[model samples]
Target: MLKTIFPAALILCLSAPVLRAQDLPDYVGSGQCAACHEAESQSWQGSHHQLAWTEPTADTVVADFDGTRFQNDDLTVAFSKDAAGYHAQITESDGTTTMRRVHSVAGIEPLQQYLFETEPGRLQSFDVVWDSEEKRWYHLYPDQSLPVGDGLHWAGPYKNWNARCAECHATGYEKNYDPATRSYASTQAEIGVGCEACHGPGSAHIDWAETGKPVEIPGVDAFGLTMRSTADSEGWIQQCAGCHSRREAFGDGNPVPGTPYHDAYRLMMLTPDLYFPDGQIREEVYVYGSFLQSKMYANGVSCMNCHNPHTAQLVAEGNAVCTQCHSEAGNTEFPSLPIADYDTPEHHFHEPGSEGAQCKNCHMPTQTYMGVDARADHSFRIPRPDLTPITGAPDACTNCHQDQTPEWAAQQIEAWYPDSDKRGPHFGTVFAQSAVDPAGALPDLLKIAGDEGQSDIARATAMYLMGAAADQQTARATAPLLRDDSPLLRAAAIRPQRAAPPQEQFQNLLDLLSDPIRLVRLSAAPDLLRAPVASLPPRIAERFGRVAGEWQRSLGNRLDFPETHLVLGGTALTMRNTPAAIGAFREAVTQDPQLLDAWVMLVRLEASVNGAEAANAVVEEALQANPGQPDLMAMQRELQQ
Candidate 1:
């Protein structure tokens, strides 16, 4: 039903990470920086950064707000402007008076966000619609069937920018929403992102300039404080990826620019909801996690390698950017690409210079995130439409030829790559076999898991099959890959090990408890719980307790979210706190009653602690939740016996 596809180098930098106190500049504001750094400043001016926030003025308002009246069913909206400010008033079907003041315009072209200044400089996401067809203005949120009362709609607290969006978009922004007061007094160092934002406070740098002496500043060793060196590649990447990547913030934002990525944002792991089985982007995941999964990234490729960090521009034109490493013939260092006409359509099967012929179309196909504009996958994969049904990843073919079927895409692919071993040995044949007979595909799937040359995604997918197949060898082989450098590989490596490693894998489990990706840590947490605590080292055992406590406090009542409960439940069991474990498992069961794993674990925990009665009740609940899940039926029968 859903199309799933698997998944920037920028090199030019502005400020070096290492800087003498004298090298720093004072917080002269963007206007001051605009004086000397005119080029960079001008590029940013009128761009999204400059237009991040705009006052209600004729020049700023692009929408046809000149006495415009828009209606959706019984609800009517009237736009008006005055010397004081611009406002939109909506008269709901229930006679509700909703007055929305225009605070700022979000984006240009495809879709835009209209900000409503909830307080001074504190703008909140409000009901501004996009006219998709006319490419104009319409209410994007709150359909005629859905009322503002529905918490899932845009008007809800979850969508509030003050709490969610401001930190990233606004410069020196403080999300000063006090739950005690139930109000906000948010302020910013400056309106939009400025030089000081990424470079750290220039006060120390400026002080050194005036005094001619070295001085200490907060973030001197970071982007602004230090010099940029290739040595800090991981650090530099983490700094940009802090915002760019699809990950959860582990702590507030204290992690330094050069800090290890895992120390800052915890990357979310591959899950059925977040990703397709073939490691394609599924939901609204940010890019870093996906990009890191690419072979290009693993082999020292970085965001800066392709993009100018300051201007955020591509390093070169078209396919030329790719040719830097991938030559027309072959590279002396990495001889992957054969001698061929890459730019021509003979290789691509599309007209030259057309959008369809672009290397990105086949290699980096787009998948939509944030509900609107499509984001190109960074995996830099070779097109494999044939793997769509076999691997369950959306192929580049289905992406463009949406009207056509996967079978059509596969047929087209066969014509081009007739003798191509892109599927790697028995992958194509075995993967195809898996679709028809999963049992038959188990051996080849296990072999694929151990193939080092195979794409990490394909290997990961193989590991996933092992879990469904319940193969011990596949789980054992995957355990070592958890220590793999690529987060994507590490994330997938844990899938099969979910049940196999009980005590021997406790150290590995503890090691990943602090993984940069939440998905990996979350995945490992459950494994850790099932592991024998007595076999765990004192240090690792202590880490389990620490992480479990932290997870509990942060998760709170958000346990209603299945992900929250999963992470919490896993950590709870690892700490050997059975009561907390039972509670978390119960909450998980409550949220998704059909979660077979949760039901089984809860029944086991209840049986081990509160006797057979509680276990029987949990089994009964599991049965009620799922009509006839094989796992549940088996577990229920075992418990009854």
Candidate 2:
């Protein structure tokens, strides 16, 4: 059964417009840009961005496809190339063998993942990937033995190319999902991340070039470009962060190239799931969130300062990257940087050529992801072994010295730099302490939230945690932040107020419905759902309705995601629509059987509305899907009783 929860009218209104090649009229493609910019085109020829996604071809496909068999647990995939194309013969544990043609190849250097079309218009990234460096095949998740129906399976909802990856990997992409049919007719102007991905559509630029490069125009931009290179440091950083950061999209597909970061997406803060309490990269969070915590970002440094935007490589190799600004001959671009010798043995307290003396080894430690890809932390933090014991966060010092305790590392650091002012109160201590003693941590959290010196992301994180104990004190502390200049802070301030009274929620959040930033309006709209719209002024009621519609449209855009169905189920329950709620929850569990909460909700609704027989059936199905799960087992026992 296709459990389509959304109404036909709503889906039609909110669905992404069907965008084909002709629909993207302004997009002249990357080849158009190459005619005028030869140097940049040459640099980007084989760069990671250019090869992010490509059609599988002889030159493009680097994996061994000459009848090679790779085994992982009970699954064996035979790779071979025929006259037709690259093919994978996957043998499942249940003794079913399926032949799938390779539809596309993703990435290049460290690891390359192959995509296979599982169903019509649905491409799934295969779990088995090619390790380019070692020239071998390996499973991305080696430990897990996922069944065909599992959410984490290669062909499951979570690994769907249209929903999860297409926008980032391709240029001018649109995920045209039809909820009625639950299928994708996804389209992209270019196959891989191209010159137009960063610079916006190139038709106007080409026109400007052919017309003798006019200095001024009545309606067109000076250069006929959408995104200007003359933007400030923060502008440039946000442009890159649009794709690099871990974030939630506002609507279907990617936003236009020049859209402000907050307007297009909501950035994930320093949450424990994605980051260590001290704001170190704990997962594959890319670089934006960590970089936001750095002194380099605070001091007006951007991605182009250290990395060549064309090649996606560091401007200088090794310690020379840091010495560009940190050395005695400081960089002219950043005159505010103090001239200092940081690349010597005296500063590092290690042999000049040793690993310990490397700037990145101490400050920007690397964490491996995707089996073979090693990504570095971009926080550019000074080593602080002293706080590791208190915050339970990893320190760079003890990371290299596995045998030594954090206390031992702290003592060594103290001996080397006894008068270090860097050893001060850290937000990580407050965040860690909040887990065991939230009451004790509240005052410190309040202080951190209001601290101007702290990074905006860190401050926003502090505000988000205080929502767990949303009391009068928390409400009062966060009230001022609602008016903060930063959209991140303003959006985060809405979270702690979720527990406030209906009237309070109305009074506090009504103004934010019309906030200039889309993220802030989206954050505030849900909490204001309980507002007294009926008795309110006509203008106020209209404002609430408009913002609520925006929120629903945002939800509609991501209906392809199973987690979005969970949100829909909850929202339906809040509206007292039992049947709609049941339908949404059923859809959620149907799409991804591992959603325990959705199953529980569906069972409870069925019991209340349809009787114990229906509820018991749901329980049995959940138990079958998630075998021996304690919560589901308990539910099954309860149903049997």
Candidate 3:
């Protein structure tokens, strides 16, 4: 949703840097690099990186923005030419200053960014992104209806790059926006993610090359020329992960490429906002967070391993890319007998050339985010048709055939994969059904929790669902995962046993009190309080008290905007902070009143504290927001009964 643009004079008009006899870093822009590295540059130029941000000139702008007026709701938005460049006049539902300058255009066919000058040299993200293929301008946050003058409206502070986007989009960018002075000064080494971004700063490397002197560079080859990502040298991989991850930036962009990931960006742990009860992509957690949870990343695979960094092309053609790792004779280290005729109807049960046969169409399914941009999940998961009916996640079959049901997909899968026992049951399916039929799935969920063969994500999911199961066996099964290296897995482990021995649970949660993941640390907070205070380690109890105090200080801060509050709230509840838990639920409702969990939690909180009358009012408001939600209707029936 972040849109970036360098000053036109600063971008297209800048003189190309002179390359000396010494091979300088590929600063000649991707075009000049294309001369010798033709194949690589060609692929790079066609990639999302090359087109990340572009000018809307006739040569670059593929969409029909020329005098086009797209109407939405009661508004008429028209893009036309001006002396400065292109401009748009949006006449909204209520009449106001209907014109704004279009400082930059984001993309071509798929999505277009409209830029607004917030301050001198400061451009912010706009909620309205034009989908050229669809030929419409839809809201980026389609779930919420913004008031005309609200800050979250198309023109708002939350969407601005100074706070939200500068770190990722531009190279060596600094976000130095001072609220008190109402002044701003930020710098980018080059607009868009330039060569130096992944390569690290070229000053030292360029100097070493010119002088013909040896220099040390962290996570680089001996020649100081290339990045190294041998399992032993994954430090460089963390550099690429900075922008690619779903994480929070620490300090003011001080951490450079060689800096450890934990030092610069705190990776997000699995939360319900960015994922379902099962670890499937929900909101845009970016690639790194979800990808790290994959068997691929854990087994030494990397982003550049599949994607050609220079050209941005797949290493091999289409499904062939997958064959390198998942071959007939699988890689010796992680062996699995490849199923025969995987490319044919015998395996996929679809026509050979159809999209259904594509490996990514099933495993790396696309989640259309930012309205127009469809980000394919990099997590290579087996398609789970059974989860489709319970959770609203799109199954591979229904994704292709929208009119078909999950039952239809399940039937088709059974027809081809006749031996259903070959494929394992889905964690998503088990968790979804547990919300309704806890008794039936409780034993299976416990088995999944302790199944070392299952994915860590699947195991974590099993642990989380077992909280509602309220069984001693499930609690015992999940205890070991609290020590998991992945904070996501650890956070999930905390959920199942809130009512257990306070001393053991408190000691276990205490060790992770300072966990690098925000969600993990957040989760530990409520559990510390829920435990008998005396049972907690004195140091951990103090830390929990401090974190709670900080949460109180930032009481008005809405976790809902980040879309990770559901997970954060769950963590807070586990720790036993009713006010923070209530606030989180309140923010969720404020953002989207139709969220049934928010209503249900709010009602539960009210019933636990104030009484049934207060709980009923919250439920009434939720019903008004979403009249047809069966879950809310069921909750209402339970309360009355």
Q: Candidate 1 deviates by what RMSD? A: 9.6
lDDT of 1 by residue, 271-379 (tens): 5566654566777676775776678766767787787666656789998777666656644544554565577767888887887788887888788644466887776
Model number with the top TM-score: 2
- Measured with C-alpha atoms, the lDDT of residue 101 in candidate 3 is 71
Q: Tell me which of candidates 2 and 3 scores higher on TM-score.
A: 2
Runs off by more than 4 Å, candidate 3: 1-46, 54-66, 119-122, 132-145, 176-187, 211-242, 245-255, 258-285, 288-300, 324-341, 390-393, 401-405, 437-446, 464-477, 494-505, 513-641
User: Deviation in angstroms for 517 in model 3?
Assistant: 7.4
User: Between the candidate structures 1 and 2, which one is better when assessed by lDDT?
Assistant: 2
- Model 3, 111-177: lDDT tens per residue? 7676677568677766667777877666677566565644466655467665566667665555554
Report the candidate with higher lDDT, 1 versus 3. Answer: 3
State the local distance difference test value for candidate 1.
Answer: 0.61
In the order shown, the candidates' Cα RMSDs to the true structure are 9.6, 3.3, 10.1
- On a 0 to 1 TM-score scale, where does candidate 2 land against the true structure? 0.95
Q: Rate the local accuracy (lDDT) of all candidates.
A: 0.61, 0.84, 0.62
Clashes of 1: 30
Clashing pairs in 3: 43-311, 44-311, 106-113, 526-574, 526-575, 526-576, 527-574, 527-575
